[model samples]
Target: MAAEIRTFTCLTDNFGYLIHDPATKATASVDAPEAGPIIRALEREGWTLTDILITHHHGDHVGGVAELKQRYGCRVVAPHDKSTKIANVDLRVVNADVIKVGSLLARVVETPGHTLDHVSYVFDAEKVVFAADTLFSIGCGRVFEGNYPMMWDSLLKLRALPDDFRLYCGHEYTASNVKFALTVEPDNPALKARAEEVARLRAENKPTVPTLLGDEKKANVFLRADEPSVAARLHMKGADPAQIFGELRERKNKS
Candidate 1:
């Protein structure tokens, strides 16, 4: 049988996700922004939480972990980086680690940038990627704990995923991301089309998570630093991709 995934809003702009594997009757929360909504989702699905897979130590992402774990006695999986300082960890994982939530399997990919301890989870069989702060639908996270080149490398790692993978980010920043993206690639037809789509989704007070990786690659300017047109638009022709990426990130920070 197929696993079920549920997504809901939490803590203002944060997103909370629950994935349940019916075969083993196991359920895991991608990140816990808060407890109420996650509990509600579990109640609605009638699935018991067995694990909490943390992408990073950010408060908004981990705020509900302790409460939920105490309530369910769920196992908490976290990053291998000790500097992240996440408490209540049952297992600490690094890149290429295989984590199990009953019969469901997730591969870890270290994607430090926003934070050196940040990680992304990929359920390849399910074709889903929980990238958290590393990547967004039309943008990427600001490089806070790591340098621009490190962040660029992290973005490249995600961009290398299969184009068909579904991307689940940490927030609802699509509309604003699209607006900033336009200034970078004003003439991109794909971006222009996606802007209209994002506008409609936001107008209805809907969430725009779980977008296709392929769509993001085409429309997300942050992933297009290597594109000649993008470089030309930024007036940085024939530049190193990392340098171009750095420039784009600097502009986004200011935008």
Candidate 2:
């Protein structure tokens, strides 16, 4: 049977995910944003936490790791690169590493950009990706630790994934991200439709997590940096994809 994944809110805007494999009764928390919410979710689901898969070392991301580890005694799986400290790690993984959660297998994808040690977990068997910080529903993480080119390259790695993959990103910034995308490609029908849809979703105070990669490619401006039309929109025809991405990210930062 396929892995059962749950998404819930954490902190102010961050998201929390729990991936459970029923066959072996193995459950893994994608990240420990906060111990309270995670504990509540576990109690609600009646699933015991067996592992914690960390994507990055940001405060919000790892804030509850220690508490959760103490409370549940769950194994903590973190990235190999330790530019930032993440305590209580049982396994340190790198790109191409395969992590097993029960019968479920997740391929570690090193997508450093928002942070040099950042990583994404791809559950290829389930066609789902937990892209914390590095990628978002309608946007991407800011280039805080890596250069523009490095960030762009990291994004490319995600973009290379199959379009059918379901992307479970870090935060709930789709509303603002979609608004910013309109200014970049105002005439894009897909983007325009997405903006309207996002507006309705937000108006109802709904979560827009688990967006499809295919739809994101068609609507997300940042993902289209390599598209000639996107470059032309900024009067930057023939510019390198990395340069276009940098310009788009800069504009988004200011927006």
Residues 1-255, candidate 2, lDDT per residue (tens digit)?
888888899999999999999999889999899999999999999999999999999989999999999998999999997667898999999999999999999999999889999999999989999999988977999999998898889888998999999999999999999889889889989888888888888889888878899988899888899999999998999999999999999999998
Model 1: residue 186 alpha-carbon error in angstroms: 1.2
Error of 2 at 103 (Å): 0.5
Please report how far candidate 1 places residue 226 from its true position, in Å: 0.7
What C-alpha lDDT do the candidate models reach, one value each?
A: 0.92, 0.92
Clash number for candidate 2:
0
Q: Per-residue lDDT for 1-255 in model 1, tens only?
A: 777899899999988999899999999999898989999999988999999999999899999988998999999999998777676899999999999988989999999989999999999999999999999999999888898888889999999999999999999999889999999888888899999988888889889888999999999999988999988998999999889989988888898
TM-score of candidate 1 to 2 decimals: 0.98
Model 1 regions lying over 4 Å from their true place: none
Residue runs of model 2 more than 4 Å from their true location after superposition: none
